[model samples]
Target: MQQSKGRPRTAGAGQESSAERLDGHGREPTEDAGHLRYDDPWYDALASGWGESAGAGEPVPAVVAAARREDESRGAAADVYLEVQRSAAFQEVRRRYRRFVVPACVAFFAWYVGYVVAATTAPELMARPVAGAVNVAMAAGLGQFATTFLLTWAYARHARLRRDRAALELRWDTQELTRGVDGGAS
Candidate 1:
């Protein structure tokens, strides 16, 4: 009996018409193209492994299945914990800003509105100053700019230190993964 060839030959030769119709020549097909399935590679690999196992006269053992289950559980737990830590850090930063930055910004806007109203309504009073050559509005506005700059500079320094610490921790974790001493596949 003659074995039929797999997959039909269309109206094209190698690396010419069919290549342009898909991606470039030598590119693999994608899932949406409908010519191939998503699990093709994994299923093909599994089928190939079955041939090897049959030749060796051994089936899959139960201990390997149990170990794989345990490994999958541990991996899922690690992923969940990492996600929690990431989200917790984000929430903490937002909480810190909410506790200080939000109220400060609201107070600043309120003060600004008050200043504009007072400057428009009572220019003579605002122009009078406690110190030489500096009126009350000028002093207050200058104080606001100074406070904003100091806060921004301090926050920048704090953020840089925090990021450096986080990076160092991540580097250590990555080093541990690279060592592969935890019985995990690299």
Candidate 2:
């Protein structure tokens, strides 16, 4: 029952405490739990029931199963995309794209380089008048612009005619496959 003026009463060497010892420190808890009575008070966080799992070894399996299910779903999605890519329809779409793009790129690049080389090496040819004021260089430059527009139109027309429908069908098929993974919801 010894007490200091500012400090609360500390446990005497032989004094018995009535409050339960939660964290094994035999220091008696103060009546006012909101206030800190001692400099080094006992903190039994587990006694407040905050840090507890759902029984012994029950939560581990549920967490592992959830993670494994997610991994399986992700792997299934990747497999679906890979299967579509390896399919004949997808190969045809890629082939059509390359068939148009490769030759067009080479032809346009060669035409541009030829214009530059001709303008640099044979300026007199470029300077020769096409009609009145417009020279060969001007005509060729205008042709470059015209060909760019024509190529753009042709590319759009070719995609619309050849690849777009098949690509759309592939996309729908892909979505259907993924939906099957989700048990085919409405």
Q: Per-candidate TM vs. native?
A: 0.38, 0.61
Q: Considering only N, C-alpha and C atoms within 3 Å, which residue pairs clash in candidate 1? A: none
Candidate 2 versus the native: TM-score? 0.61
What C-alpha lDDT, on a 0 to 100 scale, does residue 137 get in candidate 1? 79
Tens-place lDDT digits, model 2, residues 8-82: 333454554443222222344565765333322333223422222323211111123445565687688889999
Q: RMSDs, each prediction? A: 14.4, 18.6
**Candidate 1 — number of clashing residue pairs?**
0
Best by lDDT: 2
C-alpha lDDT of candidate 2 relative to the true structure: 0.70
lDDT by residue (129-158, candidate 1, tens digit) is 869999987987787788778778866676
Measure candidate 2: CA RMSD: 18.6
